[model samples]
Every structure is written in structure tokens, then in C-alpha cells.
Target: MQIQLNTDNNITGSPELLSRIQKVIDHELRHHAASITRVEAHINDTNSAKKGEQDKRCMLEARIAGMKPLSVEHRADTVSLAVSGAASQLARLVDTTLGKANGSEKGGVSIRHLSQNEQEE
Candidate 1:
């Protein structure tokens, strides 16, 4: 899978930072490597460097094969926290979405809807 990193004016996109983010994504999406095509991450400061505000924003988008891209976003005081939160959410989303695409039952329960005629009978 491929990964792209983007940073707004407030945050700097360093090589180390990119490596760290990519590592987190790879670790979280280990099982879905085959189905996931690419992931793009964006980090920005929502408050524009205002002092006491929790404005760090992280956005993640995962492209799944034959499926629309799934996205998640998180905000925190630190870029790391926001990125971590978004990464976890994106991983869960991929699992749920791909699981559904594979026809896997959800929550270990299956429900069937009966027709009106069958119910009457």
C-alpha cells in the first residue's frame, strides 16, 4: 500500500514525521494490506496557533480496492495524539467496511426478514 502525507502551514512535514505516521498506518492496517490501495494523511492547525486551544487536526483517508475511500479525522493538542486517534479510527473503519464487502456477518448475529405472506402463513 502507498501512503501520502500532507501538512498545513502550522505543521511541518518532516521525513521523520512522515515515517512515524506511515509506521502507525502500516501497523494498524497489517491485516488489510492487500485490500487497501493507498492512504493519505493530512495534519493542520485548526486554531492557527492560538495558545490554549486544542487545535491539532489529523485527517486520514484509506482507499480500498473496488470500494469508496473511507475517511476519519481527529483533533487534539498535539499532532501525535490526533494522528494516533485518526489512525485507529481509520483501521476500524477499514475492518468493518471490508468485512461487510466480504459478506462476513457482523457482531456474530444474523437477522432475516420474512415476507408478509410468509409471516401470515
Candidate 2:
């Protein structure tokens, strides 16, 4: 994916150059994938969610770099991240509201305590 174009932006007679670049890209991909898998496994075994997130970030960055033409390869990751983030935020909002309602109900208290206390006179 390394654009090996000269100043003229032409790939003319660059077959060998492209082959060499492909080999480098292949090696990087293997290295990145191995590291990513190890990190993922370690993260799965961890109880600390924060640490798991950090590990994920590190692994993703390595994976991105290992991708040839990183700028283009990362588009999928970016879109997925945005979608997941939005969904998570929405879920948190719903959970917070439901939890508060549940807690208030369990407290046995309401806004009309006076009538229930028989002091309406």
C-alpha cells in the first residue's frame, strides 16, 4: 500500500519496487496481528475494564500502523467506533433513568405523603 510514486506520481516500471513494498507490508501485518491477538487475550482475562480499554487502544494503533495506506485502512475502524460510542451513550442514559426510578420506588416515599399520613384536614 505504500505509494511508491516518484515526483511525477507515476508507477511506471515499478513492479519490483511494489513487490518489495508488499513484502514489508506483509511482515508488518503479521507482527501487528500477533500483538493484537495477544493483547486481546490478556484483556479478556483482566477484571479491570479501564486496563482492557487501554490495551485495546494500543492494539488498535499497532494494527492501524501495520495496515498499508493507514489513512485509508482506518476508515472502517473510525466508523465503527463512532457508532458504538453513540450506542453506549444512549444505553447509559437509559440505565441511569431507570435506576433512579427504581431506587425511588423502593424508598417507599412519594410526593403526596401528607394525605397518606391522614393530615389532610
Candidate 3:
């Protein structure tokens, strides 16, 4: 999947930072890479130069082929932590979305199979 990184004026989009963010996102979404077309990451310091807790904000948007895009965001004390949290959240959302699209049974029941069960009952 292609990854695009964006940062606000308060933050610098350095090569090292971009590489690290890419690796984190790649590792988290490896399972759904084939379905994902691109991922855009937006990072910023909410407090700018001021010191504050959980000021680093990271937002990740994943575009999947033939499906609506999904987005998730996280805030933490550090940029890495924020990105990690957002990636994890996005991974879970993608897994749930793909599972539903494939009609995978979730919680031991599938909505598509519910009608059959009702008729039998």
C-alpha cells in the first residue's frame, strides 16, 4: 500500500520520521495490504511549542478498493506513540470492515445467515 505523510507547520516532515511512520503503518496493516490502495497520515503538535500532555495528534486515513475510506486518530505525549495508537485503531477497523464484507461470522453469528435460522425456528 502507498503511504503519504503530512505534517502541519508546527511539525517537520523529515525523511527519518516519514520512514518510521511508514514502517509502523505497514506492520499494522500488513494483513489487509492487498485491499488497501493508499494510506494518508496527518501528524501535528496540537500545542505547538507549548508543553502539554497528549499534545501530539496523529490521524490516519486508509483507502480501500471498492469500499469507503476509513479514518482513525489518536493523541499522545509523543508523536511515535500517537502514530502507533492510530495505526492500531485503523488496523482493527479494517479487519472488522473486511470481515463484514466477506460475510465472515462474527461473535459466532452472521447477519446473512440470520434469516435462515429464523425460518427454521
**What lDDT would each prediction earn against the true structure?**
0.87, 0.29, 0.94
Q: How many pairs collide in each candidate, listed in order? A: 0, 0, 0
Better of 2 and 3 by TM-score: 3
Model 1: which ten-residue window has the lowest total lDDT? 103-112
Ranking according to TM-score, highest score first: 3, 1, 2
True-vs-predicted CA distance for residue 12, candidate 2, Å = 35
List model 1 lDDT by residue over 1-121, tens digit each.
9999999988899999999999989998998899889999999999886865569999999988778889999998898889899999998888788767767645232335767787677
RMSD of each: 4.8, 19.9, 3.6
Q: Give each model a TM-score.
A: 0.84, 0.22, 0.87
Q: Considering only N, C-alpha and C atoms within 3 Å, which residue pairs clash in candidate 1?
A: none
TM-score of 2: 0.22
lDDT of 3: 0.94
Report the error of model 1 at residue 96, Å.
0.5
Alpha-carbon error at 49 in model 1, in Å?
A: 2.0
Global fold similarity of model 3 (TM-score): 0.87
Residue 104 Cα positional deviation in candidate 1, in Å, after optimal superposition: 2.1
Global local distance difference test of model 1: 0.87
